[model samples]
Target chain A: MPQIFRRGRFWIQLGVVVALMAFGGLLINNITVNLIRTGLGLDFGWLWRPAGFALAETALPYAPTDSYAWALVIGWMNSLKVILVGLLLATMLGVAAGAARSSRNRLLRSLSGGYVALIRQVPLLLQLLFWYFVAFLGLPDTPVGGLIHFSNQGIRLLGLNLSVEFCSVLTGLVVFTGASIAEIVRGGINAVSLGQWEAFRSLGLLEGVGLRRIVLPQALPAILPALTSQFLNLAKNSTLAIAVGYADLYAVSDTTITQTGRAIEGFLLLLLSFLLLNLLISGGMALMNGAVLGRLQRSR
Target chain B: MNRWLDRWLTLMLLALLGWAGWSCLHWLWRGADWTVVVTNLPLYAVGSYPEAERWRPLLCIVAVVVLIVITLLGTRHGEWRRSLPLLWSAMAPLGIWLLAGGLGLSPVGTQSWGGFSLTLLLTAGSGLLALPLGIVLALGRRSDLPVLRGGSTAYIELMRAIPLIAVLFFGQLLIPLFLPPGVEINRVLRAVVAFALFAAAYIAEDVRGGLQAIPPTQREAAAVLGLSPRQSLQLVVLPQALRVALPSLTNQAVGLLQNTSLMAILGLVELLGISRSLLANPAFIGRYLEVYIWLAAVYWLACTAMALLARHLEIQLDPVRSAR
Candidate 1:
């Protein structure tokens, strides 16, 4: 009888269910009382009203007279812009640095190692502040005719327009996250066995060819998962755009809250937007991962 | 030997170096001033903490250093390991009293606690608080009860999905609304709570990985020894799990330490905030480069030290490595 009382799934389930229900009711009651006392109800209807604040660099055509919902959407677009650009730049820099860390060239290897150590050790927010307040802001107020031009074909193809806010945020995110991705890349590369490199050398392949053809393909398995997480991290870290007064989602939400006094709504929107953005990134990456695995399986 | 290719690479590297050298020289000549940074070193270190009470923070720093040294040394012996938790908890209150001063010392408000000391305090406080809370949450997520598992999973996922900046904003803005009228929380405490909650999610995930690594047979063995599920978990499972989780947990802790800089957004003048405020001063108008360089160097040193300490602990905790 004692054994039955202790081990019975039915009794245990019933107890847990009842306890959870009671706890949930208590939490709801407390929240309701708090809301009533504060004279703020849970209606999101206030989002339809005017935002009344202008964003500095918005992807969409936004005015001070736009609805709060549109303003939030503009914030979302701005965040997306930064994340997309930041991810591309960070990956490029990370891959280059990661390669440099293992290069035969002594100076390149040491420089990359030093960079990874220094950047990764410092806080990202601090680094962002450095890029903004120091590097970008310190640039002599946009040379005589605003945008400086380097008309070389390569420079033209790269399309480097140094807008202060965009450049600062991009540079900061790239440097900070690039350092992390470099470590991941290095780890991924190192994870490939030495025997494979030996096999490539035996086939009379150059070092570069060996890495590109043999090592990196195997390294992709280790790299992809870390790279995917870094993408999510980059998207989330874009929220630090607030610190530099950049018009990203969190910055726009801050403005919306200050202008409209709708903290709950604005914050909820901010949370949901980031959550959804990350979910999309994670989902897309998972699909890519599946495809990669399928290809590898077929080859096997 | 690939002489021709090597020669081309060397020439290209030389050109790159020459360009970099020229740029460095130009920046030093035209873009930087160190006078402002030299003058404001004290202000950056302790912020506006009163001159008379400066020694209080210094003392707190000394105490913290002593505690850390003791804890590191304590790990070598088994008996000391058992008392380490109690020692840490005791140090928390003692350190708080020494810094804040209510027991035979002067009272220094959290506002006065800024700069590097405050940065360290926030990191240590949040890291310590988050570890146990995260363990509980991880265990709850792995619990057999559907409701408990679901609730824990939701909390962890929600926290993970959102940015720390958003979490800080929630703490700064929404938490006040939830609190009853005439009750208040300090800005420092709010920032700490936000950091702790944010870090707990990551810690929970790390711990879950550790928990999953533990074999099911361990639990079965504990059960055969007449242990209840809870007892088996506490005695048989958690110790091994925590050992496995230590490296990842340390990584999370180091990450949390670096992240405490975000509290600057909440208007708490930690190390980074002081640097920002220094740049805003009229006297330091164009010296952003100098100020930032100094701040980065300090932050880098501290973070590197923590990373090294974590590595040391990782080695010590592993029986194979320790035996070597």
Candidate 2:
């Protein structure tokens, strides 16, 4: 009787785990079916159907009656545009400001301090609104005597022109995220050790040279993890584009949900896509960090 | 002349600030006076809120104030005491004040409250609700029972893996489908719950870290005194675990508050939503910069204060190791 009870209790624990997972799956399935009939929808078939709506700004030229796939494709491209630009701009600003924060220059230090304090404090949504309403949407539309006509979707700053939606989203994300990156950069730089600084000074190396050569090389590991984490944040922050009417992955996903009532599938795709994107980011950063570390190891 | 130059620069800055102020004033109500600005805020916000329910939000505010004072004083003694009851005094009034209508202010139900105030309330509400939820989730995740541990790991992770937006979407458009008919949940409340769950998962992980740090000897010591596992956890383990967890938890709370702006996407009239709405307005079509800057500045002020408070807590939390 005692053995039977113990065996039963063991099964109960396993049963409980199985039950929880089942409930979770049930909840997911129920919602998906309620949103869109189960087993009725298939991928790319919907892609073939006409989107029948003109997207405000698309990287690809698409008409109202374009394939739903094409619309999603266009949205995907538009999102990539922001992601690529946001990545570049944030890295540049973050690295530069972060480096400056560690600089001996008092003015530079204060400027970095002020930038971080102001940017890190506010929510990204507010920043996006500021960009959309105040910056992008509010820009003087004159376009230098009609040299080019730019609206909410695209822009013509001078003889050269490009995507305004991309620019706006990038600007918001970069400014917001760069503040975080700056701190990471500063921390990495500091982790290089004061002894290294003293040694470099004794060797008659200038501050700039020492930083570029000795400091940055040692600081790579310290910065990479934080930097990767911030990238995760950027990927998430990119979703705020729904406010400004920019069609990044989330925006596209949202539109698809509203149109097709496929909330689970749409968000599932978003989750997978972002997971892939973040993985790519971490993978690439990891490689770069390894290469840097390898070189350091070899140098020793 | 340096003095004069300083004066001129100050004047110039003030002029620029004044212009920003004017543009916001103009955008809010193109040349409208103070009375107009004040009146317009309600027209823009809490329009659907019942005037008879004005006392709710105010009462909430009063309750929050009293709760905070007591909790702050309560914490002067130890870091991990059963301050949960003490915390309610803080939360109840804030919740009541936010729902206020009978207190001579318009009682804007959650749906009616839009814009920045809505955003702040949603964040605060989620943080308030999530604390205990997070503690339970955290403790459960660390349970000796395999069932509890596995279930918890799944819930914490599933919620964490999905972007916050997905959670919000599920809460808003999807949850009602599974419920029995006529038992609809409010979307904003859903958002608060969702946000709370999301934040709690992260907090639980943080708390678990604190839980792990404590020596097994401490728990064993408590057991020797004939304490139950639960008692040992509550009386002996939790107090020390929480002392270390407070700063991180507070930091997380501040982060959740900022993240509440995402609720704007779900059509809540939080700060960001109001800013978005103003953008579509013809008069304020191009005045987004001034408005958003002002709004960002306000958020910055609040977050900066929280960051300082967190830093102070971190310093204070360092174990008071007395040297003889």
Docking class of 1: acceptable
Model 2 Cα lDDT, one tens digit per residue, B117-222: 5655776778878888887788778765667777788788666665687778777865676554446778787888888888888888878878887888888888
Q: Write the per-residue lDDT of candidate 1 for residues B50-105, one digit (tens) a residue.
A: 89988766666666666667665655677887776677677666766766888788
Clashes of each: 0, 34
lDDT of 1 by residue, A117-162 (tens): 8888888988888887766665553333434532211111234643
Top model number, lDDT: 1
Show model 2 residue runs off by greater than 4 Å. A1-12, A18-22, A25-45, A141-160, B1-48, B62-90, B93-109, B115-117, B133-158, B212-232, B235-238, B278-286, B311-318, B321-324
Model 2, native contacts kept = 0.48
Off by over 4 Å in 1: A1-31, A140-162, B1-32, B66-89, B224-228, B321-324
Backbone clashes in model 1, listed as residue pairs: none
Question: On residues A97-195, what C-alpha lDDT tens digit does candidate 2 reach at each position?
Answer: 998887765556776888888887788877777776557765665655767766664687666566666667888999999999998999899888799
Predicted structure 2, TM vs. truth: 0.80
Docking level of model 2: acceptable
